[model samples]
Target: MSSSLAQKLETRAKSLGFDVVRFTNANLPELTGARLQAFVEAEWHGDMAWMPETLTRRKTPTAMWDGAVSAIVLATNYGPEVDPLERLTNKTTGNISVYALNRDYHDVVKGKLKQLAGWFASQSGQEVKV
Candidate 1:
């Protein structure tokens, strides 16, 4: 993809609340698949049955979609207002995972992804998947 397009995508992603946006080819190293396979065999994923179920597709983007040639990575920071380690040191206070303190990040990020994908598809005249 052109740098101009990448810049536009990053700007749109930031506008949509993403803290970071990166672009890369869809291909993943063979070692990535091997590592995942080993992780599944060792039951490192635990109860997440879907991980194993989707292992083949998870190995590489092309496994999921033959036409996939590029990848757009997005991230959002969910840092807590107060340092979690500070709370950990205070035995008198109850501890809660930072994720539990706000709206579900998966849903939040998914929504933004959908919007960004729509915009990108329209701009590039290509199909997009989340």
Candidate 2:
């Protein structure tokens, strides 16, 4: 992708409230898949049964869809203004993670991603999947 297109995508993502936006190819290193397999075999994933269930597809973007050639990564920050550790020290006050203090980020970020994906597909005339 051209630098101009990337910049436009970044701008659009930020407008949709994403704190960070990055672009990368769909391909992943073989070690990534190997590490995931090792982690799953070791039962390190805990209760996230979906991790193992989707292991094959999660190995690489292309593994899920062969047509995938690129990826648009987005991130949102939910850091607390005060140190989370400080809250932990105060036993009287219940310690709630910053993420829990606000609306569910899974819903929020997923909504934003879908909107961004729609806009990108319209602007670039390319199919997008959230």
Candidate 3:
């Protein structure tokens, strides 16, 4: 990707409240697939049958889409203002997963991703998928 486009993407991601943004090639190392296979073989995935079913695609992003040359990984910080682990000590408030605390996180991230994807398409004149 062009440096200008990448700079724009990073700026957009920051504006969208994303904490971190990274770019990497779509092709993962062979070690990744080996480790995933080992994890599955050990039954560590448990009931996540989809993990094994889509192992190939997951190991290599380009395998899922031939046109995808690179990947843009963005992480958003939607953590609670206060310590979530503090609930574990207080019996009155049951402990809950951090992700569960913000149920609408998926929608919020998806909307931002869609907006970034649109911007990327507009800048690169290429199709983008979030």
Candidate 4:
């Protein structure tokens, strides 16, 4: 069952031009989650309410949602031709986080996630009405 699902996922990913695909458990690592929760409790994430919500989810992804099978962490490298830090010297203008200066990544990455979800549903024979 796992082999066929993996094969189908790979094939669908290739068709959608994905570089790689992998599966993960819903439950995050215990030590990592505990440390994250501790960090949140310490108020290290000042002014970020999302951090607490993330901590709650990290405590256990499975508890957050039923039938949650995997978590996809995707990153794209927009290689800077020159030193991005050089721009910081000219403090006259605003210096956005290097990545946010450009296009919205959620738009770019969500399409890939949608494609993967489609393939997974199809391969698994699960009715993905969503």
Q: For every model shown, what is its TM-score relative to the native structure? A: 0.87, 0.86, 0.83, 0.64
Candidate 4 TM-score, true structure as reference: 0.64
What candidate 3 gets wrong by more than 4 Å, as runs, is 88-96
Clashes of 2: 0
- In model 1, what lDDT does residue 51 have? 94
Clashes of each: 0, 0, 0, 0
lDDT of 1 at 129: 89
lDDT of 3: 0.86
Worst 10 residues of 2 by lDDT: 78-87
> lDDT per residue, candidate 4, 5-104, as tens digits?
7777777766665566665666678898888889999999999988897777668776667677765443445545678899989979977787777667
- Select the stronger candidate by TM-score from 1 and 3: 1
Q: 23-55, model 3: which lDDT tens digit per residue?
A: 998888999989988998898999999999998
Q: Which of the predicted structures, 2 or 4, would earn the higher TM-score when compared with the native?
A: 2
RMSD of 1: 1.9
lDDT of each: 0.89, 0.87, 0.86, 0.70
**Model 1 alpha-carbon miss at residue 69, Å:** 1.1
Q: How would you order the candidates by TM-score, starting with the best?
A: 1, 2, 3, 4
